[model samples]
Target: MNGCRAKGSWVADEKDTVHYSGAAGGWGSVRGMTEVLARERPTPAALDTLRRQNKPGGFMCVSCAWGKPKHPHPFEFCENGAKATLWEMTSRRCTPEFFAQHTVTELRDWKDYDLEHQGRLTHPMRYDRATDKYVPCAWDEAFAAIGTELKRLDPKSTVFYASGRASLETSYLYALFARMYGHNNLPDSSNMCHETTSVALKKAIGSPVGTCVLEDLEKCDAIFFFGHNTGSNAPRLLHPLQEAVKRGVQIVTFNPIRETGLERFKNPQSPVEMLTGKETEISSLYLQVKAGGDIAAIMGMIKHVLSTEERRWREDKRHVLDVDFLAQHTTGFETVKAHAEQLSWEEIERESGLARADLEKAADVYIAAERTIFMYGMGLTQHVHGSDNLTTLVDLALLKGSIGREGAGISPIRGHSNVQGQRTVGISEKPELVPLDRMAEQFAFDPPRDTGLNTVDACEKIISGEVKAFIGLGGNFVRAIPEQVKMEQAWQSMRLTVQIATKLNRSHLINGEVAYLLPCLGRSERDMQVTGAQAVTMEDSLSCIHGSQGNGHPASDHLKSEVAIVCGMAKATLPPNPKARWDDWTADYGLIRDLIEESYPEMFADFNARVFTPGGFYKGNAARERIWKTESGKAEFTVPTSLSALGLGDKEGRWRLMTLRSNDQFNTTIYGYSDRLRGIEGTRDIVLMHPDDIAAAGLAEGQVVSLASDADDGEHRQVDGLTVTPYLLPRGCIGAYYPETNPLVPLWYHDEASKTPASKGVPVRIVT
Candidate 1:
């Protein structure tokens, strides 16, 4: 491996000390950078004006959606959020002339960072094949062209795609437009991640979202964190963990490797800690479970808890099981107990890479806690049997009667701010019959009852030529999906590809037969609706709905709101109707709210009046109160029969591979090349491997290896030149960043229940 030298710094070799000349001078460098940024370009002072109570406006954070605000603070933005905000607020633009200077083919070769670092899009563009460049197009002309194209294809053949970054109103409008146009083909970013949580939660507890809120974190006596890296993925969460530690809360973490955030954290906010260079202890007990062994670990914990409770009940009159809650609010306990009893400690230890004593200790902590919260991330849901893993967690929560409580429940940390909102507004390609029927009646159009493709299915459809056009409502669609080569090819094969974005990305470079990049305003930019500057709503992980008003100037004067773009496309595609007036909604976002109010009256009641309040209302879930919506009106326990049943790592000697993003990144965007907390720098080629595994493979540290997956279908998938680094990870487990390793994941491989790609648990073998 070669190290690049910084400007004015001599290259160090052998024993010479390595230093970052660019990062030296600490706070002075940061202060100087801020000055440089300000001097480079003038920006709106409105952005500096903080919201009342010093909290960010409820618009979902453009970076990552980890949790919501319970208390206001002067500093709420995380590191990644700061990067996202700074990137959005940059005084740079990519005008039509910039596109005119470069062809799509030429732009395709540019790095992901260079493509987006060019800054925001300044105008709507349409590809001109004759000129081999994209030229500016009037909003009306673009809308009209989209309408003409919509009329040419069958509604089922056209897909309306959405990203998690979209606002609640925008997502609602996108879904309404699709239903009104007679198709339910809504493939979204959720399908690429966390779809398993939705599926498992709905089946086990009769709800799709997490039951715990941010406030609940403070109230919990203990928290069990699974398969998530708080340091990199959810940095803002570090404060809460720090606070919890200060309050004597016990945290038990389960992941393949010990994450820095979960080990020790220095709260930058604390003057004493900052001055003394002291760190807050995070995890009381850290268990390094093997990748794809989350279910086994969870099952082991439950098994221990049950046996201990039984033994105590026999000796003393103490019972760990909430018998009353179980008898009233749940069923199938007998079956669950029978299956759990059959799981031997040996098998559990072998599968989970955790000892019986470790699991017992964790269970003891859970049993002692009056209130506990179980939180997990993609690590628990990126396996072929991810839904089962989720079910197991739900079963544990139910066993302890954690739901409907103030301090305890199951919480799955969502990635995007509005991802939950998108799902709430019906972005799923597979809509329930009730929503479909309600939408059909409300829109005065018969929506197709047949199920539609998810992200994986959508890609397969495009590749097979079954899908014709693709319309994205705010995301890098090509980068988010699995199998990069196939995704790019499928995108190119589309008849028309429309991208509604605030900036340029690799997705825009992969053009269709007719491509259009429609510039849209960002969450931090002012959006002028017919009702004047308006606010958009976003639902946090805890189901608290909040409103956000952009304080910054629009990226471009020509950029439109996502709702406006959807209305424009709908007007062009659908027949003119009195009740479902797409043009009227486009004129003002308030009218869209009015329609939502009329449609989902139960949830969107007083949509206009309630949004003006300081903190938005909460969308109540009956399941959160232990009122199950299942067929039996109770939570159900599902028993996973065999490892093969999950269809992950079924092949011999095949280990499950999970792809994750570094702390410096959000989704497909790579702001920097280093993951500071992980001790990785300069490059993204390093893979996390167990020391024992490296020795077993006869590979020395830093050895380059090719990770490959055998395709039962006779095609080979491989990711080469991965620099292996021995870390404190569970044996038989490995970790690498995504998109770069996405090609190794087959489109056909996915969770059966949720249809989400198994990006977290791909089965592969290592070669040197």
Candidate 2:
């Protein structure tokens, strides 16, 4: 914490101030985007890239998984999208010469921001143990070395990790190559983020992906925002929400802290709004629930609805519930009704930190709206009972029959651009979730049927020396995961690590004994194959599959496409198989698309032709069609017995810590030091606490403090040197930016079902 400026260290800045009262988007957003463009990519070419983003035949935005409109505006990109583009298309390069100047040990002390700020990686490099640096290496040589190491170790001992940045074509090849190598150890960013959504939704509604399309939001009478901050995560979505508010749609928000984006937003894309300073107020009702209290809060809403329906039924036999939809399309209504009736108001109030009257008000809105969309983010999913929290949300939706139709369905707001697509194309660890038989028939090889490890499991195995090899598609793997201290050290002990990325990150610096750093084309860069320029497809959160063709110049001549990199690794590792046409597939992406159609005929039929269709085509969800694919063949109501949102009970002097992203950042990638929406600038190492909590702890504004986890686990986890800033939130709930505060969350403290790290509800105490 002292010497190294890595994850744990924090720097105090006099310029940092808290004045958190402003609309999310407007001139401020324009200014932020302009600043990034000026610093990173201030050129006509960069502006052109922005114009084409999210447009037909243009590159997809590498930001969030929000879908594009049928007829998109000329400038569909948002501030976050602009930052992601410049971050990828930066002129700065991390060459072998630069790597030679700095040793791994020395580079470890540098901050995560500094490491990535070095810019796009320029060439293939291999770790040199003798020199303690990364030396230039040929792509062929690096792949051969990785293949030889893979041949030496068991396939189960290796982990094939993918970030959500990879396109559908690249992800398919990556998944194919791993199964050919004899294992399904395919762990990706989803395991850390939305695995709870996948697990819960699949059981409750029969499909993992969200049922609603972009148009559904427009058609909805009410939009419920549960633990989701749309501004920082998906800025372009603000335009839609702004329009919804104008249309008189009831926007109900339930979160521990008041996110400005959820409260009000001025459409940055709208010139009149920006010029006239007309901000559209969002969220007709804002309920600030305690951290990890989403389950209790949602259940409270259910309780109110159930009580009202019962009273109305007794009065005149009038039904508040959708009796027909419940009887025909779903089952287990009695279980949900009984569970709600059993819950006490005192217990719900204590757990949720919400009054009964407010819950009733929210329920009334839900009851009045003909169509409502239930949307949630990591806040509800990253808990001990994360799956239960989601299922409980599903129960509420089912109570009012707010699903299986247009404008009414569950939406899990995913982070990365193609995160949902990766899982759809079989980048999953679960053997049952993937089509092993079809894959075996297509490849003419026996596929591995054993369940693979997830992010948490993979890290534990890496620490225990069970996993020897690590292959990342595109992400800061070591830096993004929890238990930073242990995982970073354990990552170095692997036999071989191959990172296929667009830029330099802390993960590349924390090299394995025999590590190969292979630079690949970013989403904004041209990915030319043997068949001219290639167009890849990505599935957004709405399950729309669209074509994305990069139009910019490559960062370096040595850079290859992610598809090519995966094919190269496959050729180098797998034994000669007549059925596997890696070279042909790499040459013509249409062949890959054809094979994808052959593998998943139901979803990817006519993939090559339909992908080129304007605005892409929907991958059709069964749940959306009211066709349940679950074991029961019907939507099931799951009753979560536990009232504790996070199993961690209330402890004296301990605060429920929820990690979040700043307006300037997305996931683990830090764009700049300014969080303009929050009125903070210069640093991300500050902690957000309620004014009452700050005074109760005897802490003054800007006072430096440390946070230690209150887990019963043997390890003492803490983050030091955090500046205290007073923000309006629930009294016992505090907030800090993630990856910086990841150390406080233990790897084992995750959702019981999904194994997703409980990042939103780590019980910690502030220590001076």
Candidate 3:
């Protein structure tokens, strides 16, 4: 960790120069090149030993959604996964006495990195506003207080927020607790990122999950990756991409930025490549599309493919359409064909920011492949027309008869480890009729009929005084939500705020009138239940459900399992009723799984027995087999209009800013201070700009500038002193990390269809 420092500043090396320039506030800004060097170094042997996987053992890496290892790489973990692993296995601790000395106000000023770096919490803690400090409290006392506050407020006025990081068993218990309390305001992390995917998939295919599994990826002749950077976001997928490249699979990458992962990836596992310093070439063809332009690009490709099919039919009597499959499994071919024929290339190129030649080239790749896969990420969903973008991709997949094939289907790479699992086990605020009716029949209580508030709506309710309390299961609510000022104010206005967290964070700092921080066990920490030391289950991005057992001891003997804590609070809050059986469930996680099986029998059949498998089982996807689940029992096509009409306007000289994360960061959790692949060290605040745009803005390389959004409120949201880093991105486009540039996004700005905050495509004006 040694480096040169001058007046609290340090010089950066070649690799560190980029990261240091972009470093955000906190440890990233304070540390220099040394942090980058530390991250690149090989992982310690102790960590490798801890991550050992056997036929029956702990859960897989939660950091990325890349499926189980296809061919075992020497390093089982990716860089970001390693960071998450190390952070969870860190040797830091935060005791009750430490909280007693540090007041909530004092901790509020601390950076997010510094606060979390303080270490894991050992026991339950309740804030003492009288002394301006937190004091240790017995579990019973804390539960009683939580029960009292929950009882005081109407069920609808209380929000139960869950993060995707929580275990399936714990999430099930949480949902049960909320349902027993007679509210459905369960705003989990899925609502923020993949709600669009859920909504779009349900509308078009009748299923909310991806149709393709990890193994299916290897079978595709062509893969179209849109709006995702697999290298940094899901590094484990690099191995598959490397394999695909070696097999001569045509990979087409459609993104606004030329991501490093899509460009050239050096597989650390390949002996020759690693030894010779050779890199695997990925993305045979890379197309740079503008933000919010995904729909146009997809439609354009579909149009070109259809045209090619028509030409082939006229020349050789060969049809690209799978006539038998379409007749039996689909319904919207006529409408889709009509729209594709009518779409103008000019409109497509204008909206998608892709040239006509690029669209044709992509279509050529698609037409040549017998089977193809379409994969997308949040970049496709964080726009005003996110649903439209997703629908177009589905349209393309369906047109080529890709669905229900071996290596061909639509895949949405969800971020959180068990994000899909949480949604599966009923963490959704908007429960369909089937699950609700079943829940009522199983528990013998009429489930809440009215649709609940989403993440954004919940925050709005709190700010508008419609909600009086907030209870979070595992996420950093304040930091994750949009409109930080309003979110912070809402937390302060709450009558009670209860956070069941494994560590300290910004959410804990935003204290309520009656605030409590109940320290819980981390995922890497052992959970002791009545049965014995129990392992929690998590569903990976690919729908593989597996068990996770903590190798490390609990931060302290006082820390309780999240499931146990939820049961304790539920017992204290619910009216005297034997049906609740909160006590029996608290002693063992198996009991909770049994209840989940009772509620969702179709999805969780023999949950306990199935979880012991090595690779885990795949949750059934009807669309995977080309069984259309849409209203028409077919994959529907959506005709995309203008991006300008969507209200993502590019005024006179302004550029659209897409926020992304560095390799060192995972969501809001800053692991270290550098992004190695991006050649950035000790920095997260710099903005990536096209070299031409930088020059046009009268800004030189390494020069700092201020960026502001033209919101209606006239609020001066500026990120001052950001160095301009030149990149090969398209002109009138800029990139920066979220939470850092969150201020630039307007409170009301979000996808109209999904209500997800549009963190990706935001229009901003920069000044020198």
- Clashing residue pairs, candidate 2? none
Candidate 2 — which residues are off by over 4 angstroms? Answer: 1-17, 42-44
- Encode model 3's per-residue lDDT on 46-78: one tens digit a residue: 254345531246546657666764344555666
Those runs of model 3 whose alpha carbons end farther than 4 Å from true positions after fitting are 1-49, 53-56, 69-74, 641-646, 712-716
Model 3, backbone clash pairs (residues 3+ apart or across chains), number: 13
Better of 2 and 3 by lDDT: 2
Task: Sort by TM-score, best first.
Answer: 2, 1, 3
Q: Where's the lowest-lDDT run of ten residues in candidate 3? A: 1-10
RMSD per prediction, one decimal? 4.1, 3.7, 4.6
Worst 10 residues of 2 by lDDT: 1-10
List, residue by residue over 1-768, the lDDT tens digit for candidate 1: 343222334334211222222221123223432543453242553246223311545444676776556565566665556566666767888898899899888888887777887888999999987877889999999999988888898888888899888988889888888877878889888888898988989988888888887778879999999989887677778888788989999999998766767877776556676667577778999998877777788888889889988999999989898888888888888888888899898888877878989988988899899899999988888777888888888878888798878889999988887888888877877767237667667777777777877887788888889888889888888877777786786677788889999889988888888888999988877788776887787777777777777777887889898878888888888887777777667666777777777767887888887764444577788887788888777988777754222355546566667787865578888776655555556777767776677788787777788888754656577888888875556677678888778888888888888878888877778877
TM-score on alpha carbons, each prediction: 0.93, 0.97, 0.92
Error of 1 at 302 (Å): 1.2
Over all chains combined, what TM-score does candidate 3 have? 0.92
- Between prediction 2 and prediction 3, the one with superior TM-score is 2
> In lDDT terms, which candidate is top?
2
